[model samples]
Target chain A: MQTPSATLVSRFAMEVASACFVMAIGALVCFGAREFGIGWGDAGPQPGYFPFYVGLIIVIASCGVLVQALLQRRDRRESFLTREQGGRILAFFGPMLGFVVLSVLLGMYVALTIYLCSVMVVQGGYRFHKAAAISVATAVISYVVFEVWFLVPLLKGPLEAWLGVH
Target chain B: MENFGNLMDGFGIALSFYHLALMAAGVLLGILVGVLPGLGAPNGVSLLLPLTFTMDPVSAIILLTSMYWGALFGGSTTSILFNIPGEPSSVATTFDGYPMAQQGKATQALTLAFMSAGTGALFGVVLITALSTWVAQFALKFSSPEYFAVYLLTFASFIGMGSASPFKAVVSMMLGFACAAVGMDGVSGNVRLTFGFTALISGISFLVAVIGLFGIGELLQTMEEGLRFEGLHARINIRDVFHAIYTLPKYWVTLLRSALIGCWMGITPGGPTAASFMSYGLAKRFARNKENFGKGDPNGVIAPETADHSAGTCAILPMLALGVPGSATAAVMMGGLMIWGLTPGPMLFIERPDFVWSLIASMYLGNVMAVVLVLATVPFFAAILRIPFSIIGPMIVVVCFIGAYTIAGSTLDLWLVLPFGILGYVFKKLDYPIAPMVLAMVLGDKAEDAFRQSMIFSKGSLGIFWTNSMLVASIMTIAMLLLFWPLIGKLIGRLRRAI
Candidate 1:
């Protein structure tokens, strides 16, 4: 049998994790609120006054959700994502996440072409030529719309600069 | 009378060739937005928002609002043909619509749906002309405390009426509020939540949030399903159109009732989906021959379709008059208004009568255009539905990335889009209501500003919220209702159990 790590994360586990995550955020907010001063100043309520209360609400509410989730029986909770579905989601998500990093390095237009082509070919099992053509077309169309027509400049890199385009 | 005169002047503005052309294009695009699953008014509007930044305010509002009206019309098209409801508001239509189609009355059913939708929207526009000016004037009396109370009321309504757990809604809303608190603190000129990131000198872009959460997030979710459309074959000639028009008079009572239901729900916070469901149920209960209902009944199509369109149209009223959006789409429109440097409220009427009235006029023209265009272009939209997700899905993501990139033209916005997309996907999967998050993000900074101003005026005394009679009454009512909301939920649960 596979180890526990190989099993799908259940709804209960996800809920618990989310609750913990929110609590951490709540704590961070409360800490930040403290630094900003949560009390009323002579002028008025301090900057942190509203945020402190907001943080407090999150903390209290998250604890309640956590307790409710924990008390619920394992079999009673619905599956958040079965292993296969999780893999399928990750198949797209992982590449998309990497696409952002790639866009940062390669410039947005070049990155867009690579991102679209790879997603279409690798994920959808399309041939490389069709994927490349569509990706190139989409990027060029975007350039026309945003750069040429709207005149809104997008992020560029070495490739764009080397081509003597602003 | 004055409102009518203003509206007439607005008609003059909207009838110009530029505005008319924009309306036609907007409606056509809107129909495509509504017809495409995983795309809706929010994403469509968000995607087009950057483009609108180039147009004059009158032309921009006309374009965006026309798309909105077109989306409402297109929502019912797929429901009647296939059992698929393209928009959530159209879900009620599938019950009678698909059955009517199955019974080979697809033409008549489609006609009834379109006609009723048109009638309902026309009726709602008339109501707006009668009521909105008065509402706007009433809102002119509001101060910061009153404004804060109104914002509170809007947030509380979301919590109380939300299908998600109230705590979850609050969590989502607070998360949005926290996100809005990032960037600079307008009051102190100190950036509190930036955590030392220089890129966040400007606040979190509402445009980016919308594109990521709705557009990219939705695309990601669609990819999971690997959605393939099986569109229904539909055809309508002029004869069928005339026949549908001729038969419209028979359902006058249903049309009137649904329009009223739609207007009431839209004026309140029920939104289009609830209005449609409520109108359908009410029509069934009050129908003269209830036995014939749900079995290819034309009135069944009329009721939901009318209410959905009316509610969608009338939802703009709250956004215009009170600066409170009655639905997610209205919230996005309100965002658009703010981005244009025009804050929506009573002041909008006073400050920009031309803009306000023309938008109202465009609503009339937009609805008419939507009905005509939708009726003429059903086959084209159906053909679009046949494109497989493998091709369309990546294209959608590319568009979303482009839309996100247009926000401040920073790649920083693009980086955040994917994460927000994941957040949106998870929230949707976990059944968290996203509207409140979006609305809160839009309102959070403004609400806090209002609260701070109010506090300064009151010399940091919290009693100002209670001491003012109008604020007291509204705030107390909303607070008590929200406090008892769990009890109400429990009571309803018990009642359902008993039933």
Candidate 2:
């Protein structure tokens, strides 16, 4: 029998991982705050004094979470994500990452066209022409609203340069 | 009476055709965003903030607050029609609103919800009108210690009233403080918590954080849920609407009680979401037909809607009078206030009476306009929910990123949205309250400054927090009580059990 529907990760594991992540951030803050002395100077608190204690509290709180998560036996068996849910999340997240990367490389308008068109066509199972029309329409509308009317310039790449639409 | 005269002046300024047009546009846009899941009031207001950058502060605030009122109304519509809360505050509305719709009383439920919300909002504005002048005048007497105590009270109440684990709340709040502490220290001139990224030299933009967390992050969660809206399309008949309006006074007790709960929560930072839930619980507990609560009781629809709107409207009072935002949306607007070179404390009332009063006057006009506009536009918003998620979802993502980029025109902010989106998604799933985090980030520097200033005044003595003045001492005592509220509650529970 295939195990395709198996639990991908347990809730307990995810909890532990997140707690560790918070703890790491807290440690980093504490470390960084030390650069500026975290003590009270003659005048008052040094720049880092507030942040140092803030970091320490974070560490302590996350530690509490970690300990609590470990002791909760009932939560250990709960599934954080099943294989199907994981696939669904990745399906949505993968395109999002691509959109960000493409927006950076090509200008945001071009990226918007590609991203919207692809997501609609591939995931939505829409006809390609319909997706293209919608995507192109969105880009044009956004251009009018933001650039023409509002006078806020967005990021542009070679396509806009070639079109002389800067 | 002086306040009444000031309000009349505010009306004279706000009655212009230009401001009225802005109010209508803001309300319509507000409804659109509010009807859509994952784009709530905070996200809508923040997204619209950049557009208001060029406008005068009075007009800018009028637009934003109008949108806010429209959003609160729109959120309940989705709850009734789709059993999905478009905003967090409207979650309680779904308890009875959806069932009422299913029972084919959509018109009645919608009418009652809108009426109650309008009534509640008006009550909140009236409260603001009466109390704001006095509060602002009182706040003018506050020094650094008093300011610190007020900020402390705000944070402590969040912990006391928050539904999330206290430890998790602490972690979320401290993380925000850490983020705020990044970039440079204004007092010491030494940059702290940047971790050596040149891009971070200008500190974390709370606007970007909001867009990422509330906007993109919410979209991610919606995606994971694989949400598909199947809304009940109701053609709201005018006669039925009129009939429902005629019946609004039957639930006067619920309306009045909920307005009070909403006002208290708003002033104390328990926020609209918590206020709505609390109001719903109380309504259910006290209802004559408790069994009808989850089965489409009209009071269920009325209670939460009233509280949600009242709390939302009243939350602005603290933001204006105390410079301590009462809600996430208020925090974002307070940031916009600073961006416009307008400080948000008691000084604002004396210094820029026009800005403060006009905004107050607009609240009276905006809510009335919101009620009229929302009732007329319900079917249109419902039609929008028919758009497939594949199309709408990606469009929202694009909107979010564009909003982020426009904040500073920095590509780095665009990248920042990614990790923050992940953090937001995870934090939400793990039951962390994101509001405190957002508030802390916004108020972090100010709170830090106040604390540091107090310490300097007291020569680094910790005792100064409570020993300074009777006002400061009493405030600190209240803050401490709130901070330990959970434990105090437990102790009381044990005593009752023993008795």
Q: Number of the top candidate by lDDT?
A: 2
Say which docking band candidate 1 falls in. Answer: medium
TM-scores of chain A, one for each prediction: 0.91, 0.94
Highest TM-score against the true fold, candidate? 2
Q: Fraction of native contacts in model 1?
A: 0.44
Error of 1 at B294 (Å): 5.5
Q: How well is each residue in B31-80 modelled by candidate 1, as lDDT tens digits?
A: 98888766778778888888888779889999999998888877788888
Q: Write candidate 2's Cα lDDT for B1-499 as tens digits.
A: 9999999999999999999999999898888889988788898888889888998999999999999998998999999999999999999999999999998899889989998999999999999999999999999999999999999999998888899888888898889889999998889888788878888989999988998889877888888777988778867889989999999998899999999999999988999999999999999999987988899999999999999999999999999999999999999999999999999999999999999999999999999999999999999899988989888988999999899888888999889998998888888888889999999999999999999999999998879998988999999999999888888999999999999
Comparing to the true complex, what docking class would candidate 2 get?
high
Can you write out model 2's per-residue Cα lDDT over A66-136, one digit (the tens) per residue? Answer: 99898995746888777877888888889988988998999999999999999999999999999999999
Q: Given candidate 1, what's the lDDT at residue B350?
A: 93
Please list the Cα RMSD from the true structure of every candidate, rounded to 1 decimal place: 3.3, 1.7
The weakest ten consecutive residues by lDDT in model 2 chain B span B222-231
Off by over 4 Å in 2: A1-5
How does each model score on TM-score?
0.93, 0.98
